[model samples]
Target: MAILSPRRRRSTALTVAAVAGATAAGVCLAVGSASAGTISGPLYRDPSSAVVRWVAANPGDSRAAVIRDKIASQPQARWFANFNISTAQSEAAAYVGAANAAQQIPVLSVYQITNRDCGGASAGGAPDLNQYQTWVSNFSRGLGNQTVIIILETDSLALLTCLNSNEINARNQAISTATRTIKSANPNAKVYLDAGHSTWNSANETANRLRAAGVQYADGFFSNVSNYNSTSSEANFGRAVISALNGMGLSGKRQVIDTSRNGGASGDWCGDDNTDRRIGMYPTTNTGDSNIDAYLWVKPPGEADGCRYTAGSFQPDLAYSLANGVPNPPTTAPPTTAPPTTAPPTTAPPTTAPPTTAPPTTAPPTTAPPTTPPPTGNGCSASVAVNQWNGGFTASVTVTAGSAAINGWTVTITLPSGAAVTGVWNAQASGTSGTVRYTNVGYNGRVGAGQSTNFGFQGTGTGPSTASCAAS
Candidate 1:
C-alpha cells in the first residue's frame, strides 16, 4: 500500500477564502454578508520559498525561467510539520509576521502528530502526545490574531490502520485537543483537518475519524494535500464526507482542497516520483462554491516526495516537468522515463526558516497567459504578461532598457475597464483601478544597457494584455 511522504523543506503560502460557507449537506451558508469572500484576494507569497530561492540562485539554470514564473511567483503553504519545539513559536511568528505585513492570509500545515503516517516514509513526529500538545500550544502563540488557515495533521485521521484500537483513540484525542488549542489562541484561525483524498478511506470512515479528532471545534476539513487526485473527485468526496458528518449530527462545516498537485491524474501517494502530476490552481480564496472555502497550494511545488529524491527537497527537473504540464487537461500519464530508484529519506525538515525582509519582486512566467508584443517607446520596451483563473489574475510587467543605460524609467498601463489592482510589488504605482503609472522604486531605478527589471500585481477582472515602456 502507498503511504504519504508529504514532507516539505520550508514554508510560505497563499489561500482563497470564499464568502460562502457550507453545511453538512453541502448547502451554502452566509459567512459575513453575501458579497464578502466572493472575490479572490491577495495571499502572502514567501519570497524565500524553496522554488524562489532556487530560481534566484540559479537564474542561469536551464529551468529557471519556467520555475520562476510558474512556481516562485505564486503563494504556497509553509509547513510547520517538523519537530522543532523550542523554536516552533518563534518560527511560526516570523512566517506569520511576514504574511501579516503583506496583509495576506497565510496557509500552514501542522503535521507533527505522534506516529504520523504510521512510520511510513513521512514519519517521526513528537516523542509523545504530551510534548506534541505542548508544541501545539507554543505554535499557536505565534499566530497573533491574524486570519490564518491551517491544515491540521495531514495523516493523523486518515492513515490510522497501522494503529491498534487504543493507539487510534489516543491519536484522535491528541488531534482534538490540538485543534482547540490553535483556534483558542487566534479566533481568526480556520483549522481544517485532513480527510485523506477521494481514493482513500470511505466517507463514513473518514467522517467517524474526523469526529473523534474534534471536527466540531474546527472550521472544517481538507483533502489531497500532497496527492494528485483531480479537483472534481476531491470535491465530490468532500461532499460525501460532509454528508456523513451531518448524519452524525456535526453540521455547518466547510472544507478546503489542496490543488497544488491535482492538475493531472492522481498518482501514487507513497512514492518518490512526482513527475506524473502537474501544478493545479494557484492559491486563492475565491472558490466559486460556498462549501469550498478555498483552493490552496498545501504542498509547495518542486519538492520531492521521497521516492526518487530526498523527501521535501526541491528538484528543478521535477519542477520543470510539473510547471511545463500546467492547465494540464486530465489525462492518462504519458509513456515516459521509468521512475528512478526509490530511497528512504536521510533527513526531512517540514519547514524552512522565514524571510526577514521584503521578498524580491518576481519575473513573468514564460508560459500560460500569452504575452503581448512588446511595444517600444522612449528608449525602452515592456511586456504585460499574465496568469488568470476565474475572477482574478496576476500580471508581471518587465521593462528593459534600450542599448544605452537608463538612469530611471516609468511605464504606463491601461488596464481593461473594471480591473482593480489589489497589490503591487517590486515597483511603485500611481493608479489602483484604471490607467496606472509605474515607476522604478529606489533600488531598482537603474538598469544596465539592455538589462531588464520587472514588477507584478494581483487584481480582479480582466488583466491587460499589452504594455508600453517609457524610460530616460
Candidate 2:
C-alpha cells in the first residue's frame, strides 16, 4: 500500500475543508414525508457480512440482540470494492442475483480510486487507472437487469487536492469511464457519485469536481458515506451540490444521504467515543426531498472508521453503542387503535377484473395502499396493506383484538405465488408462499381489545396482492 506522511494527509483534509467553507450550505430540507416503502428499494442482504456472522455465531449473546435489531436486521450494501479483482465479476453477479431473487435492490460501492484515501486510514486501491477501469467494467457487467444502486468511489471528489493535476485528470477519466460502462451494461441501474458529506467539502467545489468526472450520465451523487453527519445537514449539502451541478447544465440529478450512523449526535465526528455515534434513520425512500432520493446506510453501523479499532473492522462495542444509543422510532410502538384495515375475505380476495362500481355493502378494491376492511367476525382479525414498487412490495399486517386482549398471536397469511419474504420487522415471520406465518416477538405480544400491533414484511412481486389472513 502506498503511504503518505501525516503532514500530507492533514494538508489534504485541510484543503478540502477550505473549499467547503465557500460553498456547501443554504439548501432547505423538505418537510414532505417519503412515500412509505423500504428505502433504496430493498437493500441486498449479504450473509457473509461481518454483522451477520456475529449474529449467527452468538445468537444468545445480549450484544448480538442489539446488533441484530440495529444493524444485521436492516438490508444494507454488499461491498465488492475491495475484494479480489479476479473473482469480482462472479462475486458481484452472485450478490446481484441474490438481491433479484429477494426482489430487492442491491447497493454496490465502487471504491478503488487510483490512490484512494490519499494514503490515509483506508489507503489501498487498484494499482492504476487502467486496472481500475477493467475492474469496474467487470463489476458492471454482473448487474444483469436487476435494479441496483452504484455508489462510485467514496472520497474521490472530496479528496482531490491530494493528487497532482495529472492524477486528478486520470482519476476523473477513470470515474467517467466507469460510469459509462456501468450504465451501458445495465440501463436500469442507478449510479451515484460520492460527494463526501456536508462537513468535508463545499457544495460548489464538489459539484465542480463531479462535473469534471462526468456525473450527468449517472443518476446523481451520495453524501455522508461512513461519516456521522446528521441527515438534515447532509440533505442540505446534497441540495447545494445538486443545485451547483444544475447551474452547470446538469439538471435532474438527485442524491442519497448516508444515514447509517448520526443518531442525532451533532459534533466530534472523529472521536473515539463509540456512543457518540448511533444508528440513524432506518433506510427509507421517504426522505421528503425532491432532490434527495433516499436515506441509506451506505456505511453499515458497527464497522469502525480507523479509531476505536482498525478501520473497516466490525467492532462489537461500537455496534452496541449504535444499537442502544438511540431509542427505537416511535412508530415501532404498537398502535393504540387498529389502523383502518382492509380485511380481505377468509379466502383469497378476487384477483379477477374489478367492476367499475362497488356492490352494495362491499368496499372498493384498493391498490398501492390496501384499505378494504377485512371480514371481522373472529375475536382476532388481521388487515394487510401494501406499498409496492417495480418488482417488490412492503406488506404491513395489523392484527387487532375484538372481544378480549390477546396475550400471544399468530397470524398466517398466504403470499402471492412466486413471491418470497425478504425481510420482516416487529415479528418472527416464517414459511414461504401459500401459508406464511408471523408470530409476535416479546415486545409486541400483548394487544388489548380494540388495540392493534403492527408488523411488516418485504417480498418479491409485481404488485400487492390480496392475501387471506387468520389471527389466532
Candidate number achieving the greatest TM-score relative to the actual structure:
1
Per residue, candidate 2 scores C-alpha lDDT tens digits across 11-78 of: 01100011112211222111223443223344555555677667776767878766766677665665
Q: List RMSD in Å for every model shown.
A: 22.7, 23.8
Per-residue error for 289 in candidate 1, Å, reads 0.7
Worst 10 residues of 1 by lDDT: 349-358
lDDT of 1 by residue, 79-188 (tens): 77678788788878888997899777788888778875445344567989999999999999999897888889775676554467898889888889999999999988
- Name model 2 segments beyond 4 Å from true: 1-40, 266-268, 329-472
State TM-scores per candidate.
0.62, 0.61
Q: Any residue pairs clashing in model 2, and if so which?
A: 20-202, 24-203, 34-286, 342-372, 343-373, 343-374
Best by lDDT: 1
Looking at model 1, residue 428 earns an lDDT score of: 70
